[model samples]
Target: MLIAVATYNEIDNLPIFVERLADTLPNVDLLVIDDGSPDGTGDWCLQEAKVNPHIHCLHRQGKPGLGSAIIAAMKYAVAHDYEVMVNLDADLSHPPEMIPLFLEAWEENDPGATVVIGSRYIKGGGIQGWPWKRHMMSKAINFYTRWLLWLPMADCSGSFRAYPVKLLKQVDFDSFLSQGYSFFEEILYHLKREGAQFVEVPFTFVERQYGASKISLQKAMVAVGTIFRLGMKVWFRA
Candidate 1:
């Protein structure tokens, strides 16, 4: 299995992240795709690479969108012939302990499962550290997406997901237009259009305790616009 983390300015959390993954996940190849964080995240990964044979790191020249980082990781996963390519953020919001949940879910429906989503809206799933305003906003977005796009999935904005390589290859990477955090939403659309089997597993959605949030006024507006545009595309096709 190819386990990949897309990182940006996560140097401080790298050590702890790796240690937690090492303890919980066994025999998984660790792939890090760093977009040239000024804090020497790539450099730290390079040093760790010396002793850890399962760890792989890619350092880009500058900051790229998370979509590109995961796409690059998928290309590498394809080159390595991995059956499943899992992608998650390096911000510790995605707990390393949930790796087994994803593995079991995938195996139970293997050869047919296309996507396994680490969900925050299913049973045993809830968010912590988020204010009521933020939580409501997320739920509002989820509801709008479900009504507009007719998607039944609870967390349309989820980033922690695993895809069987074959299903991923079905997506037109070059044609994937969304570059920001909206990429996750776009992927859900593509998968839905292709009739990919999606499984949602419950997970605790922990808020990031460190580092500044990348979300901004601009991204928020863009997210709304993207959803509207995607909803239109889907609606008109019907």
Candidate 2:
């Protein structure tokens, strides 16, 4: 299993995230995808990599989209023959301890369990620190995405997800068009279209305590446009 994380300007959160992940996932290999942050996050990763053999970091030139970082990690996992590739946030919103639950779901070898998502929509799952407006926006986006893309899952917009590399290889990266937060929604739709089965595990969704969140008001525009655009592609098979 490869635990892949996407990060930007996470200097304060990075070390803490790394430590927690290390403690929780002792045997799993970790891959950190760091977008060039002026906060010296990339340098911090380099130092950590020297001490921790299980930790690896990929440095990018600028702040690219989260989807690109995930796709890059997916390609790396596929190339290296990692059976399971787990994608999560480096901001600590997605708890590292529950990773075993995800792995156990895949252990069953059910054809219907290709992607296991850590979801907050389930009974034991909940969110924290989000304003009512932002919270409503997130709910609306997921609702619209579910209706438009027609996925059976309740949580379609979370960043904590684990994919079987074989099923993940079905989609073409060039066909994946989202460049921002909507990338999570788009990829889930694409996975369904390609016959990848996704399962959602209950998880508590905590807000980040580090720097600012990546999903600002600007991402709302991208989310609205990208959702419909990708919806048409999936709904109409365009």
Candidate 3:
């Protein structure tokens, strides 16, 4: 199994996150995809990768997008012959300990799930530190995505997810349109069409303690537009 994290200026949180993940799953390989953080996050990752055999880093020219970073990770996983690849935020928002549960759920399921989502909307799942307005926005986005895309899952926008490499290899990453947060939903839609099985594992989402949020109002609008366009395709195909 391989674990991947997409990073920007996450120098404050990346070290702690990496240590916790190493402690939680000591043997798993880790890949860091950095988008040229001027704050030396990429430099830190490069130094760590040189010393830690389990850690690897990919340096990009500039701030490309979370989606492209993840796509790079997926391609790397496939090329390296990894059986499974897990992706989570570089910030400490997603718990590393829950990764074991994700692997357990994936293994225990009959025939195994192709994608395992660390969901915040499920019964045992919850979020911490988000205001009511942020909470409402999240709920609204999930509901809109589920209804419009005819998606089966409750949490459609979260980034903490695991994918079977075999299934991921079947996807045409070049054809993906989403180069931002919308990639989460777009990838799932494409995978679902490829007959991928999905399972949700509940996990608590803690708000990042360091640095400002990377998400913006403009990105949210782009996500909404992208999902709406995909929804149109779904409707027309039906």
lDDT of 3 at 102: 87
Per-model TM-score on C-alpha atoms:
0.94, 0.95, 0.98
lDDT of 2 by residue, 93-182 (tens): 888888888888877655333889888888888898888997898889889989888888889889898898887777788877787788
Question: Native-vs-model 3 lDDT?
Answer: 0.91
Clashing residue pairs in all predictions, respectively, total 0, 0, 0
43-139 per-residue lDDT for model 1 (tens digits): 9998988989989999887777877788888888878888898787777888988988898889888644458998999998888998897888788
C-alpha RMSD values across all candidates? 1.5, 1.6, 1.0
Specify the poorest-scoring 10-residue window by lDDT in model 2. 105-114
Q: Evaluate all candidate structures by whole-model CA lDDT and list the values in order.
A: 0.83, 0.84, 0.91
- Report lDDT (Cα) of residue 193, candidate 1: 78
lDDT of 3 by residue, 62-114 (tens): 87899999999999999999988999997899989899998887887633336
Q: After aligning candidate 3 to the native by TM-score, how far in Å is the CA of 235 from where it should be?
A: 0.6
Clashes of 2: 0
